[model samples]
Target: MSKSDQLINISVIMSVLIFVSAWIVGLATHKLPVLTTVLNLVVGLSIFIYWLQKQIRINQHIIEGREIVVLGCELIVIACAVYSIVFKQWNGWVKGFQYIFFGIHLSALVLFLIFMLTFKMNKLM
Candidate 1:
């Protein structure tokens, strides 16, 4: 397969793995909020590392400014989500913020998929 196809496959696999692992951890540690939060943080960091590795494979010359900005923002959101999970006391507002961050994180992933598909399609044409 082409590099783009390979990258896309890897991305999808990693995403699924992350989601499954998180769900499993949540189920296994249902009584231990701390353990669940830490495991989720590890999964989140793994995703960031995977993303960084993929970014490194791209040509630096073609990297766009907005892409970097969006990535930075996503990272911040992830960090906030982790922090809130670990530090904030469980309450209605904390739960709301967590959901908001989760939404941002998923939306960012969708945007990234769209960007990658468009880029690959443009290269083909």
Candidate 2:
């Protein structure tokens, strides 16, 4: 009903849509490295844009220290994901474990970002 509630709902829907679309693209283009790379890049860029929009919307009310901490953690998570993708090579159970670890890390990062946004909103209200 409220503006913030509407924003939250929209954010949730967009997140799901992004994930599903990305998964579909990844599945469809798995055999073509170039197409897969382009699609994955598009998905990554879209998610980044969504994150940037949310950051700008909620950041005005957050304190400097909290903002820095949130950004730092986000960077770390991004770095870890990139490092895993670029540097790590594994097969079988090791690959499965790596994916599980990455999934957990990504989920935590998303939850943290949402929590930060909610905290900022609560403070503003």
Candidate 3:
């Protein structure tokens, strides 16, 4: 497969993983402590890993820049924030959800910094 295709595949898999983790965390929102902790840790780490891979595969490195993907990630985060604020009740496993959100935010910041630091784009035509 082409590099871009492979990256898309991995990105899909990671997204599914994140979704399943959120489902699990929601299920375990009020249950056994051991199970809750295990699921939370699993979800958190999966989020971190997924974002890490995306940053690498998309090559949004602060050194070897790619601005669009970074911008796109930020857009996703903005959407998520709006969804969470308008829809969510702000309790009951919100912390777990926020942990995942944090991952997304950090990922966006990495992307933003890349172009913000490296590239010198013109503002006016």
- Specify the highest-lDDT model's number: 1
Local distance difference test, each candidate: 0.57, 0.50, 0.50
Ranking by lDDT: 1, 2, 3
- Cα lDDT tens digits, model 1, 1-125, are 47766677578657655654655675587623433344435545766787788778877646588867856755664675577665764445544554454445545566766666555552321
Using TM-score as the measure, the top candidate is: 1
Across residues 6-53, which tens digit of lDDT does each residue of candidate 2 receive?
A: 676576666555554655675586622222233333444555667678
Off by over 4 Å in 3: 30-125
After superposition, which runs of candidate 1 have C-alpha atoms over 4 Å from their true positions?
Answer: 16-88, 121-125
lDDT of 1 at 24: 64
TM-score of 3: 0.29
What's the TM-score of each model vs. the native?
0.44, 0.39, 0.29
Candidate 1 yields a Cα-based lDDT of 0.57
The weakest ten consecutive residues by lDDT in model 1 span 31-40
